[model samples]
Target chain A: MATTSLTTETGGFEVRRLWTDERSRAIIFQLLVVLGLALFIAFIVSNTIANLQRAGLASGFGFLTEPAFFDINQRLIQYTSESTFGRALIVGLLNTILVSSLGIVAATLLGFSAGVMRLSQNWILSRLVTAYVEMTRNVPVLLQIIFWWSILTELPKVRDSLSLGGAFILNNRGVRMPSPVLEPGFGWVFGAFIVGAIATFLVAKWAKRRQDETGQTFPMLWVGLVLIIGLPVVVHFILGQPLAWDMPERMRFNYRGGFNITPELIALWFALSTYTGAFISENVRAGIMAVSKGQSEAAFALGLRPNQTMRMIIIPQAMRVIIPPLTSQFLNLTKNSSLAIAIGYQDLVSIGGTILNQSGQALEVVAIWMGVYLSLSLLMSGYMNWYNKRIALVER
Target chain B: MTDQAFHRQQAELLPQQPAPATTVGIVGWARTNLFSSWSNSVVTLIAIYILWLVISSFVQWAFIDADVSGTDRFACTSDGACWAWIDQRIQQFLYGFYPAGETWRINIAFVLLFPALAPWMFENVPGARYLRWFSIAYPVIATILLAGGLGLTVVTTDKFGGFMLNLTVGLAGIVLSLPFGIILALGRQSRLPVIRILSIVFIESVRGVPLITLLFVSNIILPIFLPPDVALDSVVRVIVMVTAFASAYMAEVIRGGLQAIPNGQYEAAQAMGLSYWKSMRLIILPQALKISIPGVVNTFIGLFKDTTLVIIIGLFDILGIANAMVSNPDWLGLSSETYVVVALFFFIVCFSMSRYSVHLERKLDTTKR
Candidate 1:
């Protein structure tokens, strides 16, 4: 092809040609975008500074070192009202992670069970599950959280607390459970437990290799269980039973000497789990259905039991579909756990809000919340991506 | 041997007979569906017992043992739920602190919503093409009607609460986010690196954080971001924040729809010498948007549910109003009744929306035909 001249009419410059030049246009457009963004950021920064000055607030990390001076009932770490704002926030973060992790575990179990039940052969069970999922999912999660919180709070006061086998105590204030008191000698048991865990991993690896090479299956479940559990038990006995229960005692005004679980945490955990569980069940159901019926039929033809077919054939294929959405659901459950604030769960956001009010560090507090949550989400999605890569079907 | 020979010597097949009682109708359905096996029977029985307990108790609390007619919580003498408080506060629940007389404007706006949205929501509404102008202008019309601009008293947003607040905020987010969502989605799909990166950052950052964080920004930090002299209405600030938050999710959905479009469509548009804007407006977006309608509806459901978060910052959406009642001195112990009513309202609205989405998906299923 003959090269086109830069200008058709050499005598006169045509400015319209500049518009058609894709390269310069792209560069110019990007420059404009960058300039606009810079201008926007400049405007906001100027405005924020002026507003902060006018409000008589000096914006900095200085406020973080100041005392929080607020009571948090459900602190996961050691925190007092006299603690610095930073420490309280750390306590709040730990509490948030605790409730979120608990919610995730409970939600997954509930979701998987409900999802499977919804696909069961029995009609009543499926319909009941459908009703549950619809009802739980459709109502606002905030309402559900508040609903559960209210119910828990409406229970009898601590003086009139309900006792469960002298080990657990329930009241409007909270639930108290007998926590294990570990003596120094229990460290050996812990060490042995870790060793047994390593042994379990090795045994599983060996069993898989043995099965692959020799076509002889090893009963790894039994052997692994014996190693992990029996080792700990034997170590505990050898160490002269160094574990003792710190049983809760009903005192005058409140329970003493036990692990206290606040009503807020229980309510938040239950609500988050049940609400997210509904969505997850839907995901699970869709995933299972996405695996063609012929898959399970083929598994059955190969003389596999129903459970074996589900485990070995259906779930592995279905997981390729389930895992992606399940990741988002887990993230959503974590994010939704922030609703703890509504029900007085002193989570990261709630404590941040308190700190924001106390110190007038609105910008810093909000930024911290956004930064923490964003990083958390990024981390979760990163892990999920790696898991997805592992499970993704390799195709030509 | 004789009996077998006689049976085999039949000259004609017997006329078809009806299935046995045990293999047809309700009995058969019961056998197969409810009691196919011993384990299934046990489960069915357990479910039935649980359902009975739940339903009977609910009915007892809501109706049979309940007192419905009263002026306040005091009028209830029943052992079950005191629905009388709800009856007394029903107006407040529906309209919040919106003045009783001015509710006519809200009523009018709500009525017009059907006609305005009908053209867009359904393909074959009567005179839809002519009504398109009204549909496009609905946000302006609604704002003027609700906020008062033309020959009406201006009601500040603080008065905008309750179920009306939910609808307004939810509707505002839905309306404002769509165009922005489309733009962001297109930007993400752009060939230009600057636009794509910015769009990705904006989308992911918004989506990564829970909406409550954004709400806090609106409540505490948004004002600081504005010029010193400029004071934004808290409700407007919330609407803006929520719209931005939802736009990211909407962008993701629309991007999915865009990805589903064949590359040939873009190539064909380019080959036809269509400018980018012209092609996107006339060719690409319409098809992409059409495909994204179901997902868009699902996003709307989520957004609607999320409007309850406004209550955390002290705005009185339905749940907020319910919460207020729960904490009120007179209705202090009626939290369950109030919450249940609120939950039921949300359930009805959201469940119907999901069903409609499902129906729409089925209707738009091209593979079936």
Candidate 2:
């Protein structure tokens, strides 16, 4: 009763209860926020409409039918200047996917090897790899792209091209190699390859069950490889060698009649893989270190050699930590491939820019890019998150 | 009798013997580290060879046969790097097209950066309590000094290019995004469902897309959304977009910090009858912000490096200037030399900042080791 302080309290009407009430304040704040967002959206839409009309810029995706009229230097599918803008955009998208997929494969291999080297017992090897990782990671990848492109373009001209046993040619233009040309009866070999793949899968399932039941191991890896490869080769011989090589031959101006990998593609691929590989190496190292030394020591105590300990104990545990960051690194590499535009690699953003300029439909082109990248990101993270959860340690 | 004999010790302990010749000092170290086994020996030798090959060729091309100074193609006839262009156009690379006479203004602004940043970065810096006020006012001071409006000649933003442009965008984005990041982070943590959901959607959508796409939006689509009468500066547009892009990632980083704080602190503040804003400001935020310094610095480094993307949008950043200089008629081709210089600049800046973040992490860490 003595703690009561009526005199110190504010007069009854000095402040309104509505502002003082926490629940009421929260409701009011949220309502105001909703109203503000609605008004802002309304404003932007109205302004955009008025501006688009006044500027006389065409809207909608109808312009997709219009001829691109711009020639792309490299393409996976058939493309000509007369193709529609939509087709051109698809071509660019395919090229981006091609580069990104190849870069991912290369980066993972490089990253894993570099990661192992960084942790190696040899001091010089570890230090050398560490220095490389730091240098590659800290520089802007775009600079590397430009650097690699310059080096590639500075290769000897067609007149003095570097030859690889008359099967491959390298010059300022690009790398030219024998492209596979399939003749009649190739379908039989292809079918045999498919059949071998199915057989291998069934045999693997059977082998796993057999091992569980009998405690005896089958050489599954060797058996699968033979089935997949040997079957196809044997079929090819029986069918009189249906696959032929179209070797590149030098022409007066340029090399023709071979599979050509452009300097642009190689430059982009090299730069992206090396740069992203640096980051991936760091993640790999962190993942490895996160596994306690006790795990490896225990493996050794159980009579495992160094390589066996690393393989049978360390690597399996480290993968749990490695995978999530690796996926994000892959995503970053994919997004960074957009920088291919700077070097005229004709990636999605590059072609989209051209389409935006030609059609003056800035909104649509930007939307398409945002939609594609955002969806791709969501799909990958979703899939990875599920896999990560499945593999995640079930802690008590 | 056996025990009595065993008890006798030598008057002089056996003179301390040196280790075996093959197992002592540097030789011993090398044996364990570089030649522990047949495989290790092979690996070390192969690594040394590869390292020698890379280092030798780089040094030869970059230094031994490189040209140092001249005005045109005549300056660089060597097969090595033509550093003549970099020497002559160093100013353009550093300051862009900002006028030569006004270079001192940019210099002062950058010089002032040390003082401005010191107090914010280091609490015990000399006279930090006073210097913090200066830090707070630094943006205005830098702006006035760089643009020159108050009793000084004006310099427009359009004249800005080169590395200066990179700093302009990077610094402005760093400064402006902090508050938005904090607000968004708090909103994501808020009890109000509407606010929480809105923040989540904004953060994820921004995080999902790449910076280049957003830059495209800013470059091509943003102007259309604004009223016809109002024109935004291109640099301002870029800064706004960059700030927005960075703010999302910053929100996530700050959120991690916020989540690290124990719930006990929040309840204690509430138990003391402190209001929501007061509790956050006086208690929750200080601790959260302390934990977030390393992440913030890392994000800044990433954003700084990402400023190179502006080159693709036609801004004449340092890389852009280098590209232009290499293409200049006087300097027909020195792409390698120019790119190397630019890459070195980014490497030094980014590498140092990353080192600083590591330092800050060590300093701020209070968890029991």
Cα deviation of B127 in candidate 2 (Å)? 1.8
Cα lDDT, model 1, residue A305: 90
Off by over 4 Å in 2: A1-15, A195-221, B1-12, B21-23
- Candidate 2, residue A305: the lDDT equals 91
Local accuracy of candidate 1 as per-residue lDDT tens digits, A197-253:
999999899989999999898888899899999999999998889999899987777
TM-score for candidate 1, residues paired by index: 0.95
Q: What is the per-residue lDDT of model 2 for residues B99-132, given as tens digits with 9 covering 90 to 100?
A: 8999898999999999999987766799988788
Poorly placed runs, candidate 1 (over 4 Å): A1-12, A213-223, A234-240, B1-8
lDDT of 2: 0.89
DockQ of each: 0.85, 0.78
Task: Give per-residue CA lDDT, model 1, range B1-369, as digits (tens).
Answer: 697777877866789999998989999999999999898999999999999999999998888989887877788898988988866898899889998999999999999999998887677798998789988888899899998978899988899989999999999999989889999999999999999999999999999999999998887787889886788888898889889999999999999999999999999999999989999999899989989988898888899899999998989888988888888888888989999999988899899889988988898889989
- Across A1-396, the per-residue lDDT of candidate 2 in tens digits comes to 212322224444423544556776788889999999999999999999999999987788999998999999899899999999999999999988999999999999999989988999999999998998999888888889988998899899899999999888999888999999999999999999999999999999999999999978899889999999999999999989999999998788878887899999999999999989988898889889989999998998988899889887888889899999888888888898988998889989999999888889899999899888888788888888898888788899
Q: Write down the worst ten-residue block by lDDT for model 1 chain B.
A: B3-12
The window of 10 residues in a row where model 2 chain A has the poorest summed lDDT is A1-10
Q: For each model in turn, which proportion of the native inter-chain contacts is also found? A: 0.93, 0.88
The TM-scores of all predictions, comma-separated, are 0.95, 0.94
On TM-score, the candidate that comes out on top is 1
